[model samples]
Structure formats: C-alpha cells, structure tokens
Target: MRKVAEGVYRVPARAANTYLVEASKGLVLVDSGLPGSENGILKAIAKLGKEPSDLKLVLLTHRHLDHIGSAAALKKQTGAKLASHPFEKPYAAGTLVISAPRAWSLYGRMVRKLTTLEYWSLKLFRIIKFQTTHVDLAADEESVLDGVGLDGSVVWTPGHTKGSVTLFLNQPSVAIVGDLLRARRGRLVEPLLMESISQTEASVKRVLDLDPEIICPGHGKPLPASKVKIEKRIVKPVVVAKKKEEEEDLEELTSGLF
Candidate 1:
C-alpha cells in the first residue's frame, strides 16, 4: 500500500487497485479489486494499525468484476456497508450479469474480446465468480461523503460504465476515479473499453471542471491534475478498421488484462 494523500492510501490488489481512506468514523475502502483480494486488503488495514471492524464502508465506483470482486468478502468480514450507483446495484448484487462493452476502435475491440474470454474462463473453471454484495447506498448524484464520515462527495461519472462514479475529497482536492480515466505511460487518457464515447467525454469534462490537484485512477499511478491534458478529440470515437496494422498499433495499450 502507498499513500496518495494525507489520509488516502492505495493498495494494489491483483490487477486492479483499492484505496483506503481514513475517515472520521473509520476507514472507507474505495474499490475492492479482483477476487481473492480481500486478504491483501485486510492486511493493509492491519498495517495501518486498524482492525477489520475499522472499515465503515466499501464504496464501489462501478459494477465491473475487477472493481467489485472482493466487495462481498470485505463487507462480510468488516461489517461495512457497501455503496454503489443504482444502475450498478442489481449487477453488484448478482441479479444481472454485466454485458460486454461497445467496441468502437481497435483497442476497444481487443478489450471486448479479452473481457469475453475472461468471463467464460471464470464460469467454465469456476475459478473466481463475482460474489454478490448488497449495496447500502445508491448514489445517483452528488452525494456528500459526510454521511459515511468522509469530507468528500461521490459524483456520478458514467461512460466507462453506466454507473461509474468519482469520489472527490474537498480538503485535499483529490479525485479517486475508477476506470473513468487511466494513467498510461505517464499521461491520463480515456479508458479503452467504454459504453459510450459521448458520455465518456462529458464525464471527463465534469471531472476536469472539478480541478482536482491530484487524480487517482483505478489502473495506474496517481498524476497531478495540471500535468493532465484534456484532448477533446481523443474522446471522440475513431473509425478504425479491424486491419492487421491497426491491431499492431494498439498492441501496447491492449497488453493489460484490464
């Protein structure tokens, strides 16, 4: 685990990332990472001199398997309330399975293929199924985090997922964005897989408008907001044909397991 802000710590849980926020009431976890990640997260809490019960809430940014995979285990062990957007509540609770994203470009197509393969692999092998966990708070709009003992708010930022949300801390001027924007090769860029490019663009602008000093993403290292550039054109969908050359160009970006 590494410190991102004064009271915020980032724990790398398998492929995804989980954040631990020291709140007034107790510790609030941002995302639960992948399945079998609860053990690492629990150890992180212990390293902070806190026990499992110190966890007050598990805030899910979206319904993606990597983001909420360990939510059920964490909530059960810590007795913490789980929170997510209303659109994600059912999926998180195991009522509905998440669908594959709309692929607009070569990178997006690669991601879609990988996602489909991963889904089936998990199901066929019964390796790690997404365990359902009830969502206590259905955050649809700007929700004050004080209710969960944090001096921040969760802003609905859809695109990457219909229910994706970004948590902003007022005092530290930080935004914990889950797959809303990824830090890749020292720059912040839109995620490869998204439901709608238009919605993703709009959400990116919303987060930039917040003017966070530090932006912490779900996949990579935190970056200073000033160093981040807003390339409006990049968010627009590119009409890339499924050609051999185009696929090779996106090799680096599509290398991750995301």
Candidate 2:
C-alpha cells in the first residue's frame, strides 16, 4: 500500500484495489479487495503503523465480487461496520444474483468474452461467492461519511452499477472511485461493465464536478483528474430501437450462461 494523499493509502489486491483512510478515531477501509485479501490488507495497515482492529469501517462502492468478497472476513476480523448504498446491500447480503450488463461495442464484446469465461467457471463450480453479512445503509449523497472518522463523503456515481459511489476527500481533493472509471494506457477510461451508458456518463460528470486532483480507480493506477477528459471522448449510447438486428445478434451471442 502506498499513501496517495495525507491520510489515504492505496493497496492493489490482485486485480482490484483497496484503500485505507486514516481518520481521527480509526482507519476506514474502502472496498475490501478480493476474498482472502485480508492478509495483504493487514500488511498494508501495518506499514501505516496500524493493525486490523484499527479499521472502524469498510465502505463498499458497489457489490461486485472483487469489491465485496473480502468484506465479510474483514468485518469479522476487525469488528468494523460495513456500509453501502441500499440498492447494493442486497447483493452484499448474498440475497441477489449478480450479473453484468450486456456489451454492445467490439471492444466491450471482446473484453466480456474473455472475462465471462472466468465468471462462468466461478459460478459453475461455486468456487467463490460473497459471504452473507450485515450492512449499514448509507444515502447516495455527500457528507454521509463525515461523522465516521473519515474526512470525506460518499457521492452517488452510479453507472458501473446502480449503487456505485465515489469517495471524495476534502483536504486532498481525491476521489476513490471503485470501477466507475479506470486507467487505460495512462488515460482515464470509464468502465465498460455498465448498466446504463447515460447514467455512467452522468456519474462521470458528477465526479468531474468535484474537480478532484487525484483519482484512485479500483482496477488501475491512480490518475490525475485533469487527464480524465470526458467531454471530447464521451461514448454515446447505442440506439437500441434502430438496431434490432444487432440486438438479436448480441442476444444470441451472449444468451448462454455469461
């Protein structure tokens, strides 16, 4: 884990990233990495001169496997409260089935094709699934995390998922974005695994509105917010009504247990 700001540390856990926020009372972890990632988190915390029990809260940006997998274990180990948007609470509780939105672009299609194989294998063999845990619900608004020892708030930035959110730190003007965007070839790229392109665009605009100086994505290196130019390269939503044939083809191609 490396400190990106005064009190924020970023740790890469496998393909995902986890962040630690040193607050007045204790540490607040953002996105508990993958399952079996507690060891790494502990090591990272140790580097900060802290321990697992120092974690007072684990805030999830969304309820994807890679984000929420280690949540249960972390909570159990640290006795920290778990918080997330109400829409994502069910997913974290293991009460809702997890599925990705269908891809429409060639790049999206190809990436999905490669990722779905791993997803299918995990599902088919029941290799890994998030453990059921109690979660406290937080509103999709700013200042939600104020009294929780962190110097930031969680903003609703839905796009990658309905309950996706971004953590905005006041002092450093940094945003801990959990897959709402990513770094592609050193440039900021909005996530392709999206439920709605329009909503994703809106969320990106919301993040931009904060004028964050540093962006810590869930799956890639931290990017300077200035490098994330969304206006010129925005991806327009596909007009489904005008592409019935293409829709049919996509459905046929992705109909299986993807």
Candidate 3:
C-alpha cells in the first residue's frame, strides 16, 4: 500500500492486490481490490501520513472483478480521479462488453462467466456494506499518469483481456505488468487468465524491449530486479531482451552474487 519505488507499490488485499503509485502531489491507486478493499487501502494510505487529498488518481490494469471491484465506490468516497485505457472504460461504467478473443479455453469460459456475478456484486457492493466504482479516468495508447510519477505510457498488452495493459516506466526501466505476468512466491509464470498464448507472448516481447528494471505484477509478487535481474522471465521476452541492444542491460551482473 505504500510506495516501494519512486511511486509504485503492490498493496495486499483480501487474497488479491491493489497497487498505489505515489507522486509529488500525492498518490495514485491502481486496481482497487474486491468490495471491501478501500478500507484496507485507506488505512495503508494513512500509514503513509497522507490524507484524502493524497489519493489523486485511480487507475485500473483491467476491468476484472478481483482487479477493479472497488473503482466506483472509491471515487465517490475518496474523490480520487479514475484513469484507465479506453479499452477498459466500458467495463468500469458497468458495461460488460468485449469481443470474443481469437482463442477460447475451458478455463477462460469459466472466468468469463464471472462477469455476470461481478456485475451483481458491484451493485450489491454499493448497496450492502461494501462497494465498487466506475472508471472516471480513461486514457488511450500512450497516456502518462504523472500523478503517479510515471514518465511512461500504458501499453496494450491484451490476451488476458482486450484491455489488459502494462505501465511502462522509463529512465531506469520499470514495468507494471498486471496479471499478464505473475511471479508466485518469487517464481514467475504466465498467468491463468491468458486468452491467447500468441498475443500474450507478443505483448511480452513488446515490453521487454524497454529493458525493464523490475516487473511488478497483479498476482504473486514483484520481480526482484536488483537481485534477479531481467525484464521478464518469459523465454521469448528474455530472449528479446538479450538479443536487442536497446535492452542489453537486461544481462544480470552474473558473478555468483545473486
């Protein structure tokens, strides 16, 4: 819930995670977790010595129940500005709509059905005791969340979802790759939400070119870049990182120090 980097964090929630990106003005919340998460997020914020005004922006990695189940409620309660990729706007507005992906799987079929359940929960979350919110800040392909102190853009890394995006931070190479890339208990793996392997692999390579210093994801945990050293663990992305000089630094200083 607090800033782990210049303005990035992997906030823990009820079996899920919400990220907080802090900036000069305040902090930006990324993907508010399930209905009752705001309380924990708010408490975490308070631990940072920030008030309501400190929460300036609220961004979503995508519009999944576990990811943004609290978007609308947070806006109404915290008054934080919401921002997301245009592809994710409809989802936040309570619009459950998306084109069928090129690939389909039994697992995806099950997860896809959760949308209806999520919608009902969103309504119940607001009326009952917990709550959710709509996405107010929607951005396109190269949007910058300066409020989060991110001098980069949100890349369209679909596959997990049409709107699945990754925040590409610059200067020192940091990428906030949501569930698309997860490191479970320090072991990285391709997530279970993948809609198409082809698209997911392609999107990963796209971000690898940046020589990302660290990859903080929506599941598992953050990749310890300083210790592990690499953009992403995917074979293709790592291969791309090794092949391209733009990402030559991806090579870890292997001297048995790690």
Candidate 1: stretches off by over 4 Å: 117-125, 141-144, 234-258
- Angstrom error of the Cα, residue 205, model 3: value is 1.1
Which is superior by lDDT, 1 or 3?
Answer: 1
Per-residue alpha-carbon lDDT of model 1 for 79-131, expressed as tens digits? 99888989999987878777765655666677677765346435722677667
- lDDT (Cα, tens digit) per residue for candidate 3, span 1-258: 544566567788754677776666677676777766778888888877788667987778876666776676778777888877777777666556433332133454455445444454555445644433456656553434754565677778886677788877674367777767777657655665455566777777777776787887777677754333323434454334334522332444453466
TM-score of 3: 0.72
Clashes in predicted model 1? 0
Q: How are the candidates ranked when ordered by TM-score, highest leading?
A: 2, 1, 3
Query: By the TM-score metric, which is better: model 1 or model 3?
Result: 1
- Angstrom error at residue 179, model 1: 0.3
The global C-alpha lDDT for each of the candidates, from Candidate 1 onward, is 0.82, 0.78, 0.65
Error of 2 at 133 (Å): 1.9
List CA RMSD, all candidates. Answer: 6.1, 3.4, 12.7
lDDT of 3: 0.65
